[model samples]
Target chain A: MMDTEHLGTHISKQFNADLENLREEVLAMGGIVEEQITLALDAFTNNDSDIADKVIANEKMVNAKEMKIDEACTKVLAKRQPAAGDLRLIVTILKTITDLERMGDEAEKVARMAKAIANKEMAVANVKLHYGALLHLGNHVKKMLHDALDAFARMDVESAVNVAKLDNQADEEYNAISRQLITYMMEEPRRISEVLDFMWSARALERIGDHANNICEYVVYLVQGEDVRHKSWDEMQRLAKDE
Target chain B: MMDTEHLGTHISKQFNADLENLREEVLAMGGIVEEQITLALDAFTNNDSDIADKVIANEKMVNAKEMKIDEACTKVLAKRQPAAGDLRLIVTILKTITDLERMGDEAEKVARMAKAIANKEMAVANVKLHYGALLHLGNHVKKMLHDALDAFARMDVESAVNVAKLDNQADEEYNAISRQLITYMMEEPRRISEVLDFMWSARALERIGDHANNICEYVVYLVQGEDVRHKSWDEMQRLAKDE
Candidate 1:
């Protein structure tokens, strides 16, 4: 009977080890998703189709990793029947994989935008005015994505709340960029379609920032067991401010 | 041993019953969300704060139902290791809950906008322009939501595809509304902020329409085992268009 008990303990330990490894893999995939966003933004800034193509090519990797992570989570849930922290970790992994996959899709959108603009001549030719704001906005979003992942991994609610704050800034920047592009189109209506595409790309990045903020909210839930979503922005800031 | 087997079967049946009930609740919630959108639009057109207040109050009900449905779904998933059709039903319930919740939020936004404009004097005072477009757009969205839910509940892939096509028309109408509102604001700079708020509300509704389309895509996946999400609108039309 003692030997049987020891064998059960050994199996539980091995299962936990595997679960931990799965968590690490999920985080690693998150890092790749973040990098893809950054590279996709770089492609947008530089008008580099090659880099954009690379980002598109890497989508399969992200999707595969997402599937594998999801399967691993299900396996852990089914076989181990993890309780409390382990269960929360597995659930978080499943949710984070979804966020990562969505981020990958956003990167692909940026890549498609890059490809669309790569061969087209500048309709207005004010390259700095157009690309500079986009690059700035893209960089801010990429940073937000990275910080959100870090916060999730560390269970750092403060960092997660900070990501929420950064999203407002990103929104402001996006609005400003939209205003600038609108002005450009109003000045030269012929550039309307191209500028509209660029606006969508910027909107995609802003949406990515929003999703990062969503992940941070999940982190807060994981840490504090509270739902901070759907609250007033001011209220969320106050609740998470001291964190 | 026979008694134990009977107990197991009873538990499973009870869980399945709970799941079916939860799906019905989600559909009911979806119905309320659709109603809220229509009522909010009616308030906007009729300039009726009473209607707007009703919509706002109804949102509380929507929120409460969302929570109940969510808890039921979690309970079902936790206690029952559902497979095949049962698993798909649970997943659809979960996804549909999110769509319903978001729809509720969008309706609330429209209600808020109606309240904001209730006291204010319209610069254009074009009731026809203001109420007519919103009502038409709201009707389109309501149909989309209804059809999407019907398709989901029935596991009807063809109806799901049809709902996707309707979503494009809604998008076009939404874009036209945006342009009209922006043009109005540009003509009357004093009403710029208020008109922009209205435009944002419209955009939120349009986003809700997009989510409905996404829900339809999931329904298609559930029924046909196909990922039709990333396909082009034109290609989807060609493949699944109803004559």
Candidate 2:
């Protein structure tokens, strides 16, 4: 039984309001997760072990938040047995928390890489890349995450679609950077270890971007009651147009 | 309104039976996905374009099966509105199908890699070593999937735990293969493209193994009704002991 004293609302209204709180909770968790990614990438690019430590420490916070949200969802289901649209939305939330948590996991991987390379600076400084593409991709991904959350908040299908479209550019950047890193490794085998860490970070960021896109797709499905997840990008684009 | 005459069972009994049907459907889907992985890995290791084409073709079947299972889960939720243990089991089924579908996607990635490198084998053959560890890992992962699915069927926590334990060795094999491939790339710059494809397939296999471990953990959670997913392996081992 939910307490009705917050607004002195009816039980039915309170259940409705609790669902709203769940959304707010998810968004708050998303905010912390977004910051974790920034802190991680900053730590990674600068080789700052202190920032990396912060990211690692904050991981527990993200995990705890996910558990709290999941419990809230299960409580709602067991108590209310929400039907149809509400059920779909709650299930979508359930799915997205894992993605958000996974994004944190990916960021933690980058942070761990940062921590590992913190004391090994000279090795990394020796490897030359083309035009700072990894940095560019990392920066673009953080913004993509920001917008994906915003789109989710408003259930903005168009905005989510646009963010998903940026994935192609991110893919191109990942490929270009990977090729340059390979060339670097080929030329200076001594720098292989250092370059490999950077490659993993790039791959992690790219996956984070993919997960962000996945969250937005879930939002579209939540709003439209259509499972757009199983389709291709072209099909998603068509679906977005109808929205 | 579920059809009660399917088995001529009472409504309550029919709901119970439908849950069984959901499990069987998931297992049936899991079987095909397992076959897809075996076929894809066989294609990758042999560089058989014909077999790779078969794996790629089989992907649609996997996707369709996931959709069908998803629909079934939704039907159960709407009709039965199962609570407690039954609800948790249905939810677990929902989560694992996404994982299984993603496993199929990873296999498709390996298949595509096989297709890309099928005609261009000279570079790959030029740079190889280390007792076929990658092949061994792929084969073991298929076995891990077999046991994990078996654990799900019987609610056998011990079997699930064993499969999860095997992930550490799989991780080691994947890393060793990756390092060897990197060494190959350094030795022969012309082989970078081919080696990169092999590396992607190895990473995909590693990820597939990870998803397998995740499914096992879900089995543990299903039986114990505890969320042990966010814990470390040591933490999980400790938690399991407490259980």
Candidate 3:
């Protein structure tokens, strides 16, 4: 939970409560999105159609939650007209939920891939062997998302920068996995479709890392009142380290 | 240009001017993004490295424009505290710019692919024969984006809905292209890497269609004050028709 005490101390207490509630709702949404990624990866790893089905079912709830939070942020903006940090808080929440919702969409993509792979008549051993790299990438992005939300909750710029940096690592992993999958496809052209599915799953996880990084960037924007989006690594580091 | 007449008419004339200025900025940004897609497709179709270079160079300007528009919108929200339709306009602009910036990124990606394919030793005839479906998909999405921006400029729900529905056609074209590319790759395993690049370019174009669709949805939200995001096609059509 955010420290509601410092948010809009000059404003009415009700406004503070509203901001607090908004933050919690975003975190709650983040939690569900995080779980979706986990279950999606698990479904792929274990070929669990039931788990994949659950993830697909959860997407509706995620979309509704995004709309709900977006409305709340708009209400706060319209009624409270919060300025400065308070204004940034509302804006950040609005942008953060969009990322969360997209992350959920990526998770759904992963689930669909998992379901497709599970229903195929391929051997489970081959599936696991081919997708081990995907699981590694999935865990990397899943952790990145979790830490990004944590950074947002505490308004921690250092933590945000740290998590944002992880996206580069996730990208490297994705590239390596893609190269390996390409090799597999080249070696066994008959399995090209299956290898491509894993490639897409890896792509989805990589995008999850991207969404998490975007959330971290939003945190920096919220705290510093600066738009660091599209900044180079060194420029972003300098801004984040300037405290 | 959006008619500045009705926006914030109840407020001070200055605030109305601010909203009008903001709308024009968004349209200007949309124009640049639209051109990026067009140039990227031409670069790929013609195997023209010079045009590809231009698209890559244009991305930075696109990013800067997005940040500029975002800052202006934030200022308006803080200074004007706009409500009702005015608030929705500001929020829609904020969200719309994010999609536009992403579209710029996708264009840059397409340009990079074109450069890669151009620098390769493959014959231009082979390239064209292999990528005909990709060019077809690219043209479909390009037209969809153009229509989507036109819809946004007019804020016409009918136009917006029509453009939003085009995304389904874009997806089908993308699917056909992907399957064709897969067949090409399977037929000539040695050309796997080159064909995969075309696949990625097609994927980028498909995503551009998605971003364009998102813009149309934002237009609907702006006009109708309804959240049509994540809604089914039928649901979105019903809401749009409800006027």
Residue-pair clashes per prediction, in order, are 0, 0, 0
True contacts kept of 3: 0.60
* Alpha carbon deviation, residue A34, candidate 3 (Å): 0.5
Worst 10-residue lDDT window, candidate 3 chain A: A1-10
Candidate 3 regions exceeding 4 Å error are A1-11, B1-11, B123-127
Pairs that collide in candidate 1 are none
| Candidates in order, interface RMSD in Å | 5.4, 1.8, 0.9
Candidate with top lDDT is 3
Reference-based lDDT, residue A134, model 2: 68
lDDT for B9 in candidate 1 is 72
lDDT of 1 by residue, B20-87 (tens): 79868978888888889888888877778899999988887887787677657655656664555665
Q: Looking at candidate 3, what is the lDDT of residue A153?
A: 95
> Tens digits of per-residue lDDT for model 3 on B1-243?
232325664657889789889888988998898899889989998889999999999999999999999889888888777778888888889999999999999999999999999999585465477567777777787787788878888898888888778899999989888887787678777778888888899999999999999999999888988888878788888987787
Pick by lDDT: 1 or 3, better one: 3
Error of 3 at B33 (Å): 0.6
Candidate 2 segments whose C-alpha is farther than 4 A from its true place: A1-9, A126-131, B1-9, B126-131, B238-243
| DockQ metric, candidate 3 | 0.69
